[model samples]
Target: MTASVVLKFPVFTVTEFRPLDRQIPKNHPSNSVKTYLPLKTPRFPRQVKARTTLMEAAQSGSSVNTSTNASMKLLFVEMGVGYDQHGQDITAAAMRACRDAISSNSIPAFRRGSIPGVTFGQMKLQIKLGVPHSLQQSLDIRRVKSVFPYGEIVKFEVVDGGMICSSGVLVEEMGDKNDDCYIVNAAVYVGY
Candidate 1:
């Protein structure tokens, strides 16, 4: 019978276990790396537009409502963010994107921040389907907008995927990369 041993590190001696059946192949290319991973991300800000009724209504002529929107900032902490091979977590990177959104929105920093009990900040959201080649989805037309517990957001859209633009959302930064969506930190202007 094999006996279980209780040992503490620094006190007990340890040895590396080498696999007897396998060894690194001699002919393997130096740069060749193998790993089980998902698809490579396309790009930040995805260089796409998520058009909705709002965007269309804004651009429409005559009877359509012509509204102007101001920018704002909001803080965010994403749980999932990472690279497929390197195990890179994109949470901080996504948060950085959210922080960048603040200045991009043209709203005062403090205005987008919370004042404790007073409640003066934008709420977080989960990105459903990212904007694609057109404003509408391939199958259905969805009116995409950042939802806030407070109220409706005037004007907001995807900026970049964290590659080229600043104010945008990244699903990799939302939840585990394995998930389809992630948490989104948005900037909303209230009292306007």
Candidate 2:
């Protein structure tokens, strides 16, 4: 005698049977039944390619040349937020944001040679900053690039983002200029 079992799921259905003492032949056609189910394909957001080159000079003290070609593969991304409560300097906020993003991360893979054929000097970085639209012209791109210690800066872009709100206090001595505070967001993409 044989015992048969059938299981059904929203995505698929399976049917099979087992004998009391003997096992069914592996190549038997009727031994099992499999039904294919229609599945919806998953959708993913599009990736942003690096377009603009922010820095061409080697500021990180490394002599290795960095390539900004489209062939590079992105490994990961780090995000952070920063704000300037005084002086109303948007560049300061942007630098803080970049520092905040990379401060907590440790990339041993590059130094340890975990990525085959990739060296620490060969690392590539792309930075995207979000600043208030009104203060875009005031952003100092060169000063902000100083925050990065290593890696080749391939792409740097500034888009309208972040926020502006009252800090509730304005002091002439503190260089407040005004009570308004400037906030900036940074996204750093790391790759080889």
lDDT of 2 by residue, 1-192 (tens): 877777787766676666767766879865656444545586768976864323322333233334334655667788999999988989999999999999999999999999889999989989999999999999999999999999989999899999999999998888988899999999998887
Global local distance difference test of model 1: 0.34
Q: What value does the lDDT take at residue 35 in candidate 1?
A: 31
Best by TM-score: 2
| Model 1's TM-score against the true structure | 0.20
Candidate 2 clashes between residue pairs 3 or more apart in a chain or in different chains: none
Per-prediction RMSD in angstroms? 21.9, 12.1
Candidate 1: tens digits of C-alpha lDDT, residues 10-115: 5344333333454547675532333333346766874778655543543462132222332322233122221222112233333433344443343243355544
The models' CA-based lDDT, in order, is 0.34, 0.84
For model 2, the superposed segments whose C-alpha errors exceed 4 Å read 1-69
Query: How does each model score on TM-score?
Result: 0.20, 0.64
